[model samples]
Target chain A: MELTRRDAVAALAAVGATGGVAVGVRRMQDREGGEDAATDGASAGDPSDRDTNEGTVRATMVAVAEVVYPGEVDGIDEFVDRFLDGRLDGSAHASGLREAVGELADASQAWHDAPVEELPAAEREELLRGIGADTADEDPDGTTAERVRYYVVNDLLLALYASPTGGELVGIENPQGHPGGAESYQRGPP
Target chain B: MSGAESVGDGRSGGDGTTGDDVDRTPVPNADVCVVGAGPAGALVADRLAADREVVVLDAGPRFDPDDRLARRERAIRPAYDRPDVWDVGGERDAHENAGEWFYPLNHARVKGIGGSTLHWQGMVMRLHEDDFNSGTVRGVGPDWPIDYADLRPYYAEAERELGVAGGSGVDNPHAPPREEPHPMPAFEPSYSDSLFAEACEELGIDIHSVPNARNSEPYDDRSPCVGYGTCQPVCPSGAKYDATVHVDRAEAAGATVIDRAPVQYLDHDADRVTAAVYATPDGGEHRQEADAFVVAAGGVETPRLLLLSESEAYPDGLANSSGAVGRFFMDHLFAGAGGTLDEPTRQNHVGFYTSACDEFYDDADEERAPFKLEFFNYAGPSPVEMALSGDDWGDPLLERLRDGYGNHVAMGGLVEQLPRADSRITLDDDRVDDRGNPVPRIEWTVDDRALSTIERANEVQVAILEELGAEVEWVAGPDATGPAYHHMGTTRMSDDPAEGVVDPDCRTHDLENCWIASSSVFPTSGAMNPTLTIAALALRVGDGVDAWL
Candidate 1:
C-alpha cells in the first residue's frame, strides 16, 4: 500500500481513462439522445434523424488532449471534466479550459464536416494549428479561442505527463519521498 | 482613551465590542497556536501538531485550487483590484516614484489552505554557503547562528515534501550532496533560457538547470508541470507544490486549520504567551489559548503582531528586548537588463532558461561588492507588460508583438541586499487594515553594497549580452528600484538574544512558549528566492518542536 512515485504515476494514468468517457458523453449529447438535454439543451433538433445540413462537427477533445500528451495519468480526464463543469475552482484561470474547448469545437466545426476521429492526424493538427494561430492573433480579445491553446496544451500535458508517471516516462525519480538525496532547496547568496 | 471607554475610533476588540469591555464569546484554547498559514507558521504548526494540540489561523478564506485557476485569466479585471484579496504589495498612496502603472508585486500568498505557495513559481534554490556565515567570512552582515550544514537534512526533507525537480549530478559546491537523483528531470529550457545559457557560457560563467519545486514528472499524487505561463497565478493541474499539499497531509494526520480568522494580538500571562486574541470575519472576538504560540504572519504582520501586543510584561513589545523584531529587513533587489541576440537562440522553447552563474556570487574583487547574480530563466513578463516597459509602446508595441512574440531573450539579476538596521518595518500611523491593526510601515533605503552589486551585475550581464552580439538595455540606479515579493530577514534567528529576536531554534528571547516560522527569522537574506529555504527551515523547526512537545 506504500505509495511510491510509480504508484502515483499509475494513478495519473488511471485518471486519463475518464477523458474517453467525457468524449463519449459529449458525442451522445451532440446527438440529442439523452433525457437530460430534452429540457435544458441548447438545440432540440436531432442531427441523425434529418439531413438538417447543419454538418455536425463532433470533436473528440479527449483524443486531442491525448494526442497533445500521450500516456497522461487517469485522473486527468476527471480534472478536465471538473474544470469544464466549474467544479475545480481555485483561481480564474481554471475556466479557461472550458472556454478553450468551446472555441476548439467551434473552430473544428468551421473547418471540416467529418467527425474528429475520421480526420487524419495531419488534418487534425492543421485544424489545431489554425486555431492556435488565430487565437494568438486575437489574444486577449479572441472570441472563440481566448486562452484555449495555452490552457488545453498546458492542462493536457500537465495532467498526463506532469505527474509521477511523467517523471517515470522521462526516467526521473519522484523527489518528494527521498528528501535527503535529491530535495535540496537552493537560494541565492545572503 | 483613558478609562478603556469607547473611543469610537472604529477599532473594535475581539468581541465586536469597542474599548476594553471583556467580550462574552467563548474563547477557544489549544496546546499551541500559530498565526498565518504561510510557510513559517505552517511548518511550525506541522511540527508541533504531532505532540501538541495545535491550531493555525489565517485571515484569508480557504482556496479551492480549481476556482483559483478558473479566475486567474481575469487578473486585469476589477474584481482583482480588491485590497487584502490577493497578496500583491503596493503602497496605498501613489508616490511620484511609483511607476506610471501599478507594477503588481503579487506575493502569491493565498488566504485559505496553503498560503502563498499555492501560486508560487516553485523555484526552490538553497542559500549559498556564504549566506549562512556571511558576517564571519566577509564581516559585512550578521552571521546566522546556525550555518548551512545545520539545516542540510531539513532542506532535503523539504525538497522531498515539495517534490522538487532537478538533477543530482550537477555540482553545486555550496549545497549539500544528495544521494538520490532528482525526482523528475529538470524542466526543458525555454528558448530564452537557452540563449541566456549560451550567452553566459560565452562570458565564461557556469550555467545549469535551475532547481524547482514543481513536479517535472509526477511524484506523489500531483501531476507534472505543463509549461503553462500560469506559474505565477494558479496551477489548475495541481502539478505545482503548494502549502495546501502539506496542510492536507497534516489534516490527514489530525491537524485542524481554521480559516477566515485574523489574530489581533497575543494574549499573555506574565512573560508567557498564553493565547491569541483574534477577530473573525463576522465581527466576533475569540481567544485561543495554547501552550506555545508561533507567529508567522510574514515579515510585515509578524512584527506588527509583536508591537501590537503591548502588555505590561514587555511594553516595548513581546520578544523585542533586542529591539530587532522589525529591523534588518531585506529583499532580493532585482533588476532586468535586456539585449537583442544575434540569433533567435530558441528563446521560445516551452521551458529553456535553467542555468545560472555565480561568478559574482561572492567575488570580493571590491569591484563586484560580494553579491550573487542569478540569470532569470523563467518566462519574462507577458507581451503586453513587456511592450509597456520595453522601448516599444503604442503602435511600435503592436509591431514588436507581431515580430517577436517568442523571439526575445532577456537576463535579469536577483541581487542581494545588505542587511541594515535602518531598513526596518514599523507601524504606519495613517493606515490600518480591516483588523484595525496598524499597517506595516516599511521604511527602506538601498545602501552602497546593494547599489554596487547592481552596478557590477549590470556590467557583467551587459557584457554577456554584448558578447552574444545582443543590443543591451540595463535598468539599474534610482530608476531600477522596485520591491521584489521575496521579502525576508526582519526578525532574524541567532544564538544570542541580544543580536536577534529568535534563538537558533526560532524561539523568541522573551517569550518562552512563543516561536517564529518565516523568512523573517533569517539573519542573512540570500540573493536567491527564499521560499525553498523558508520551507526547509520550517521543516527543521517542525522537527525541533516535535521533540520539544
Candidate 2:
C-alpha cells in the first residue's frame, strides 16, 4: 500500500503497458507533479479561492486517477489524459468537471494546507473519503462530494475499464467498443 | 406527402457526398420506379434490374460501409447518450405520438438507403404456419391471403439471398417446414445460453439456435462477425446483413438509385400511378415516370404516403378505395425478466442473441397470444458502465464490478399483438416534419389479450431465471414492456379488395400498376421477426410486377 512514483510505474507494468504508453504516462505525471507547479499551489493567492482553469482541472484529475484506478491498471495518467482530451470540450460537461475539481482542490487547501495535486497520495485519498465522495451518488448540480464522485472518481474508473489494457486485466480483452473478432468470443476464457 | 419533401433536409450521403451536391439531372423514364431503398425496395429493384430499367428513389442517404468503424466507436464511447448512432434525428425524422402509450417512431426507424436494417439485430425468423391461418386457426387476427405454402420457395430464396445462419431444420421444435437447411452453418450459443439451456431442459422448453442474417463464416464475400458487441447501434464489421447489399446489387445490375430524393406524391389517374414526384436537396421537384410503381416505404411511411396523396379521383387517398391504407397498425411488445446469478454467466461479451425458444409460438388462442422467448446474450451491466455509475471507487469499485458484472442473466420475449382497427397510422393535421409535410400520427393500443400474453411470457422468463437460482430482480410485464419495432399490419393484405390495401400479389386493390413491397402488406403481426417475410414478399412482388409488365 506504499504510494510512490515507482508504484505508479509498476502498476502500469503489471497491466502489460507498452514502453511508449509507459513513457507517455511518465510525461503526464511529471507535467502535473513538476517542482514549478508543486510550488505554485503554495506561492499563489489564497489556495481555497484560487481560479479554476483547465490546468487545475487536469492536475486534479491526474491526482484523482492515481487513487481511483486499480493497482493493476497501467498508464493511468496518459489514459486519463487521452480520455479527457475528447471529454473536456467547451460544453456543459467540461464546465461541470472544472467546478467539481475546483471544489476538491479548495477543500484540500483549506483542510490539508495544500492543493489536491500537491498533497501526498494517502492524504488525497483521505481527503476524498472524508468529504463523503466514496459513498455519494454522482450529481452534477448537487453537493461538492457528489460532483467529485460524478466527474473525478467515476470518470477515472470509466477511462480505466474502457481502455484495452485495463479491460484485459479484468479478463475483458474486448470491451463493448473494441472488436475482438468472432474467434475471441466463440472460445471461452483461457 | 411522406416521401418527397420530408427526406430532402440536405444531409450528407453515406458515400460522403452532401445532398446539395447530388446530381440534379432529370432521371430518365424507367420500367419500374421503386420508392424507399430498404430491404423491400432493394430486393424488388435487384430482381427487376436484370431485364428492365429500374429506378430506386430513397428519402434518406446511402451510408458508406467503410465508415462503420467510426460509427461503432461513437456507439461505444458515449454508449448511453447516442442511441440513434446512424444520425436518425432532427426535424427530418420527427413525428407525433397520438396514442396513450407513447410510441417512439423516430427511435424505431432509420430513413437511410439500408432503412432500419442498418441497425437491426439481424434475427430473421419465418412466420409460423399458424401465423398465416390466424383467423381460420384461432379466430384472432385476419388470415394472410397467401399461406406459408405459397411463400415457402420465396422464403428459401430469401434465406439464400440474405445468407442466414442457423441450425438444421430439425433443431427448432416449432419451426415452420423448410426444404433446405440455413444457407450457412449456425453460430454457436454464448456461454450464458448454456446456463439457460440447463434450466429450459428441466421445464420442457426447447432452445434452438436463433436464425440470423449475420454470418457464422464468410458468405457472399462479407466478413464474419468480429464481435464488436455494438450490433444494435452499429455493426463495425459487415458481418450482419443490411439491405445495402441488395441495394448495391440492384445498382450493379443497372438500376438507377437516387439517394436523398424524398417523394412528395404520386401523379395518378383513376386506375394507375403514372409518375412519382420527388424533391431534391435544392427546392426543385422532378417527376420520374415509369410503367409500374412500387412503394416499399415501410409500415408508417407507406401508409402516410397513401393518406397524403388524397385527390378527387380517390377521395380517401391514392389506391385507398378500400379505406385500408393504415387501418391495422401492429408491432411486437417485448417482455423481459432478469436477475443476478451466483455463478458467472459472462454476459455482454457477445452482443446478439444466439438462442431462442419458439415452443409457445403455436399456442395462440383466445387466452394468450403467440410469443418467442429469447435468451439474451447481452444482458446485465457492462463492466465499464457499471463501475462508473456506482457510488464506490478504487479497490471497492473493482470488488463491486467483480461481484456484479459477470453474475447477471436475463431472458427476453417478443409477444405478438393482434391487429386492432384503431391501432393505425394517420397523417397529423397540425404537426409537420422539417419538409413541411404532415407527420405520421401513430395511435397504438394494447388490449387485454396482448397484456395477458405479455404476462404469460414474463412468467416463463421468470420461471427460467428462478431455476437458475437467480435473485429475481425485475420482471417486465405488460406495463413495463415496449415495442420491438417490428412495424407490420398497416396497409394489410386481404384477398377481398374491400377489406385490405393490397391483394395477394401486394398490388394495390384500386390501382392497376401500383404495388407495395414492405411488411405494411402483412395481415398479421407474427411473433417472429418480419425481415425474412418482408424479403420473401418483396421478391414475390418483384416477380408479380415483372410478369404483369
Candidate 3:
C-alpha cells in the first residue's frame, strides 16, 4: 500500500518512541516525493539482516497495540506492520525491545498456554495488567512490567499521537516533526 | 595603501564566478581574501566584490538548499539515533573543555558554508546605546573603542541587507535608536505570546515585537516563512535569512567561494597578511595570496586560527602583540521559567518567537546585570514528546494529552556575562584536530555576579508565569542554565594597541591589513542577539578593506 502523510507522521513518531524502528518509512515516503519526508535512517540496511527475532517483537507489539490503543483506532494489523518494517536494526534498543516482547510471551505461555498474539483481546489486556505493565513506571532496563510499558504500550500511544489523525483527536492537528506549514501554527485550534 | 584603481589587475570584474566553479585551479590571487563563509564573511565578500577581486574560503560543505527539508526531518527523528544532520561532529570539529562547566564548542558551532546561521533562530537585535559605555556607566566591562553612533549607519545598512522585520520604535520602545524603520513589517505575536502579554501587562512589564532576520513577506528573492515550525535547527523554507543568501550574492558579484576549504593559518609579515593558507577536502593545501584579509571565522575558530599562526617574529601569535588574542572570552548565559496552566497556551504551534521584553536590558544594577527576556512559543513538550515521556497509555494517555498538551507556557532570559580574563580559549598542545593542529581548550567561568543576575532574571520570569496562574514547574539558575552560544569578546576592540587585538576599524592592531569581522571584536556582552552587530561590523570591515585597497 502507498504510504500516506498520516502513515509517514505515524512512522516518524513510532521511530522516535521506539528508538530503532520504521527505517523504511522515509524511503517509502520519498518514492512519492511530496511534502512529507521521513528521514529516520535512510542509510540503514534490511531490518531482517540485523536481528532474527523481529517477528516475535512485531507480533507482541501488535497484540499489545490492540490492548493499549483506544477503541476508536482502526487498522491495527497493517499499522503495526508498517510501523515495524525496517525498525529492528541490530542496535541495543532493538534487542531490549525484543527481550521485552520475549518476557511478555514467556508470561503468556506460563499462564495462558500460548504466545501473546494467540490470546484473545480480553485475555491480552489481563495478561498485561497481571504483569503490572499497567501500573509500572516505564523503564527500558527495569522490571518486566516496566520494559513492556516502555517498549510496547508507550510506543503505540506515541505512534498514535504523533500521527496527524491521532494528533487531531487531542487537538494537535500537526505534531512536532511534520511540516503542517505556517498557517497551521499561526491560528488557534478550531 | 593602493587605491581601488590599482587593485584587481588581471581579473575581470563580476565574471559570474560561482561556488560550483570549484576545480584544482589553485585559488586565484585576489585583492581581498575572506576566510569563513559565515554571515560576516558573506556580507564582506558581497560588498567588496563590487570593486575588489575577492575570494571566500569556508571549512564546511555548501549544503543543498533543496535538502533542508530532509535535514529537518532527520533532526526531528528520535534524539538517540538522529544523525548529525548538519555534519557538525567529528575529529575535525573536536575540542577540549578546561573549566568548571564543559563548553559545548562543537555542539554550539556549525563549520559549514553558511556557518551557525544555518541553525540560528534568526532573532536579530542592535546593541543598546548604553551597551557601548558599560564600563564607564555601569563599571562592569571595558568601554568599546567606538560607540553606538559609529555603528548606527552600518546597523541600518545591515538591517536592509539582511531584510529585517521589526515593529516600529513605538511598538518596541526599549530598542536602540534607529534612523530607519525595518525593511519589512514585523511578524505578529504568536498565540502563546498573547497569553504572556496579558500576564506581563498585569505585572507592569512590557513585551514587544522581536526583530528577526526571517522574512515577514517575500523579500530578497526568498519566500516568506512557511513556519515549518522548525526554526531553531532547520528552516526548511529559505524564508529565514542564512549566510548562504549573501554567499550566493557574493558569488553572483564575481567573488569565488571555495567550500570545504579550511584555512589553516595566515602567511603574514610585519604589518600585513600576505596570504591565507587553506586546506581542501582532498587534503591539499594552497596559499591564496591577497593584499587584504578578513578573518570572519566566528569567535572560537577566529582566535584558534590566530593562536595557530604563531611565528618567531610574533611568537605569541600573528596578532598577539598585546597578548590578548584569546583572552577576555564572553558568552550570554540563559535563565528560564516554564509551567503549565489550566487553560490552553497553544505552545509549539509556532516555532520561532515573535515577542520579547528588553525593558530590563538598560536597567542593570550593581548586583544584577542587564538581561533580555524572550517568550517561547514552543514551550513545554510536543504531543509526541509528552506521550513518549509520560507513563500512561490507552484511553488514559489520550485524556492526559487532552489535559496537558496545550496548557504550557515559558519565559527565557539572556543575562549579560561580564568578560573575565580567566574565561578564555587557549590551545591544548596535547590534543589535536584531524589536521594535526592543537585543539582549542576553552575555560568558561560563570561568576557569582552572573549567577546573581540569573537568579534575578529567574525571579522576574517566575513572577510572570505565576501571574498567569502557572504551576512554575522549574526555574533555571546557575545549575540548570548554559551558554546561549552567542560567542563574543574573544578579540575585543580597543583604540589602544596594548589593550585589545582589533582597533576601532576592526583591523588587527599589529597587522594593518588583517581585519576581524566577527562578534569576536565586541568589547562587552550586552545580552542582545549578536548577529546584527556582527553583520554591521562586517560591513564596516568591507568598507575599511575597500578604503585600504
Candidate 4:
C-alpha cells in the first residue's frame, strides 16, 4: 500500500519508528491495510477486549489442565499453573496467553453452557476435545477459536512433557522436555 | 631438564620478562607448558607429568560435574546455555557474527576443565587403516604422515584408559588388530539397532556396535550408563568419559591445571619458544616459562592461538614460516536419512544408535568422498518433535502422533570433507573474546564432492528405510558442512616444513620446543569422529615431548 501523508505516521508506528496511541492506531491500520482497527470487525470468540480478567483465566487454565494434560502425574495441575505463571514474564506473547484463555473460557461458556473451569473432569475433557475437533477441521492456518484451543492444548502438553514426572510416562526418567519421547518410541498413535 | 633450568629460550633468558613489556614480572616455571585443558592436552599432560613438571592452561572454567549436574537439573532443555555452565563470550560469539551454517556443530563446545568432552556423546570409533593414506588412495585430502599401524598400540592404551566398551574384534569388519581387547562387554544394541542390522545384512553391509568410551559396568570409579537418553549437552551420570577424568589423573600425577587462564602470546628467539604470556580471568597477566610447550587446543582455536602468538622474530605467527597456519580447516559433514515405518517394531525409544556400517568407507569412487554409515535411535525428544508437527490437532493429531511416534528411525554418515586452503580460520581484527584474544573468523562451506557423497548416502538410507517397510520423510545432503566438532587440519602435519606447519611428530617445524597435541595436526579428517584419533596422537605427542626434555 502507498504511504500517504495520513498513513505515514501509522506506517512508522508499526515498526515503532513513531510512538503513542495515535501511532498505534496507525500500526493497526497498516497491519489491516490502512483501515481503522477499532472499526474493523472480529469473528466469533475474538480476544479483542482490552481488559482481561486474570483471575478467571488463571482458574480456567488450572481446572482444564487436569483433564487435558497427559498422564496422571500427581500435582501436575499445580505444576502447569506454576509453569504458566512463570511464563508470563512481561512479553506480549505472555500477555496474549491470558487473553487467549479468556477468549477460550467465553467460547466454552457459549458451547457447553458453563465456563471451562466450572465443568467436571469428564465434561471438561469433552469440551476440550470438541474444541480440538473444531480446530483440526478448520483451515490449517487456524481460526481465532482454533488458535485459542491450540494454545491451550499445546501449552499443557509442552509443560507436562517438560516436567520430570511426565518424563516417567514414556520410560524417560529424564525426558528431553522438548523431545518426542513417547511419540517417537510408541508406534501407531497416542 | 629440570623445570627451573628449562626456562624459556626467549630474550628474557631465565628471568621472567618479555621483550614486548617493560615490566619485569617474575615468570612461573614448568618443564612443559601445555595450552588448552581439553582431551588432547590433559591426556598428553598425563605422560608429561611422569618425570617433568607440567602446567595446563585453559580459557574455560574449572567447574566439576557437580556444578554442571545442578545446572542440568534446573534448566529445562539445552542446559549448557546456562551462564555458570557456559562462557557467554568467546569463539562462539565470533562464529555467530561470521554467520556460518555449520556453526551449531562445534558451537556447543565447552571451555571448562573437561573441554567439549564435558557434553559429548561418548562415541569413540577408530579411524580406518585406509583413512591414514587417503590422498594416495582416494586423491582427496593429504595423507596423515603417521599411519594406523604406528598408532595402534597407543589407541589400545587410550581405549583402556578411557574405559571403552565394545565387541573388540567381533562383527566389526574394520576393527584394527589390537594388542588388547575392550575393558568391558559391549552395550547390547537397542531394538532400533536390530532393525538396521536386519536391513544392513540384506544389503551386505556390516552393522556393528560402536566402541564407546562409557562404562558398561563400573570401571575407573565412574558409574555405568543409566540410560539417561539426554547425553548430549550434558551427561547426568559420570558414566560418560570426559576429558576432566584424564585432567584429574594428570592433576593426581602433579600436572597443574590453571583454568580461566588464556595464553595471550609466546616469546620466542630464533627456533625456540622462550616465554608464554597468559591473561587471567581477572584481566591480569602471568608469564610461564617452560622447557617445552604443547599446543593441544582444538583445531580451530589451536591455529587461532598460533596466529595470535606473532612476534618480532616470527611476524607470520610461530611455526608459520611456510604460511600454512590456519589453513585447510576441515570437519565431517553430518548427513542422514530417516522416516516412519508402516508398522511399529519393538525398536522404538532405544538409547544410542549402537550399530554402524563402514562397508562404504573408502568405496573410493571418483566423485564422492567415502563415508561411514551411522544410525540413530528414536531415544531423545522424538516424541515431542513429532507431536509439534503443527499439522494435526485434537484426536486426529493424537492419532497421527500414535501412528508414527515409535516407528521412526534414521541412518546417516559422518561424511568426509577434503581440506582446502581457502576454507581457513583467520583472526577477526575487531572482535575479541573476554581475554581480548582476537576471535577466529572461520571461512568455510560445502563443496561439490561432499554434496555428491551426501546424495549417495541419502539414497542408500532411503532404500534401507524402504526395505524395512518405512516411508521416507526427510533426507539431508552431505553438502551441509562446517563447524564439525571433529575439527582437523589448520596446523596440519606434514613431513616437510615447506608443505605444512608441524612435523609428523606433531612438533612445529619452526619452533623446536613447541608441539601440537590435538587433531589440529591431522592432514585429513576421516569419516569417523576425531576424538579417538586425538587421544592416540596425544599419547604420541607426550612421547615426542618427553624425548625433547
Off by over 4 Å in 4: A1-68, A71-190, B1-27, B70-92, B96-108, B345-351, B379-381, B384-404, B479-483
**Candidate 3 chain B weakest ten by summed lDDT:** B1-10
Model 4, residue A97: distance off in Å is 17
Model 3 alpha-carbon drift over 4 Å, by segment: A1-70, A75-163, A183-190, B1-25, B81-83, B387-404
Kindly list the per-residue Cα lDDT of model 2 for residues B183-218, writing each as its tens digit.
Answer: 998888888788888999998889989898999999
Instruction: Supply every candidate's count of residue pairs whose N, Cα or C atoms clash at under 3 angstroms.
Output: 78, 8, 1, 19
Residue B293, model 4, lDDT: 91
In model 1, where do residues sit more than 4 Å from their true spots?
A1-190, B1-29, B75-109, B169-183, B345-353, B364-370, B376-401, B474-478
Question: Candidates ranked by DockQ, best first?
Answer: 2, 3, 4, 1
Full-model lDDT, candidate 2: 0.78
Report chain A TM-scores, every model: 0.48, 0.69, 0.74, 0.58
Query: Chain B TM per candidate, please?
Result: 0.85, 0.95, 0.94, 0.88
DockQ of 1: 0.03
Residues A1-190, model 4: lDDT tens digits: 1112322222121111222433344346557753233321221134442345545655777776666544334564445444543343222333455566776787788988888888888787777666563334222125655555444555455455433444334333333432233224323233
Error of 3 at B547 (Å): 2.0
Task: List per-prediction Cα lDDT, in the order shown.
Answer: 0.57, 0.78, 0.78, 0.65
How far does residue B342 in candidate 3 sit from its true spot (Å)? 1.4
**DockQ score, prediction 3:** 0.19
